[model samples]
Target: MSSSPFPDTDLAGNDARVGDGRNLDSILRIPVLMQVVLGSATMPVADLMKLGRGAVVPLDHRVGEPVDVMVNGRVIARGEIVIVEEDNSRFGVSLTEVVGPSAADQNT
Candidate 1:
């Protein structure tokens, strides 16, 4: 396989670059769902049903632990939760570990 500076396919991943003048613009325009996972917890249905408005579920991660940044369904990076200084109402992640393509490939 070789690197393609120009797009060779359509939005559906079909060969369209030759068929039409379309470039990778369509693919680039596609929306990807990115997620920052703080933590998660698992509990029995009975215990879950007992929860109320003020319910608090403890997560497996520690307070200072780095959170995973996932794209689609794969973990792409890790970062710490941060509060936006410009807007206190908004929160963001400060990336600490970025997974390169080679590094990510090795992990799998």
Candidate 2:
């Protein structure tokens, strides 16, 4: 009947800040946020269908531009691209900052 003390603050639906290591372990037990990456862009169907091998489909973002970090459609942070390897390997991304919940979404 009453509101939860640590109401879910994560847009990702993950648990809140657990104050201690043991608490943190319990917190870790909770499911992590489900995330998906989307390179921002808008392409018409005709243009989209014209793609071929080696065809360059430009993203709206430029080199060194802060990548949009979204949690459940809300922008939470931004970071730069990192190359973990020069060849074929997963690229790493480093978070430069964490954005707090927007004032418009804050609870009183």
lDDT of 2 by residue, 1-108 (tens): 329765644556654556634357666677645342436678999998999999987777777777767777777877877777765577766788778988888965
Best by TM-score: 1
TM-score of each predicted structure versus truth? 0.73, 0.59
Candidate that scores best on lDDT: 1
The per-model lDDT (C-alpha) reads: 0.87, 0.69
Model 2 spans with C-alpha error above 4 angstroms: 1-27, 33-38, 85-88
lDDT (tens digit, per residue) of candidate 1 on 40-84: 999999999999999999999999999999999888899999999
**Candidate 1's TM-score:** 0.73
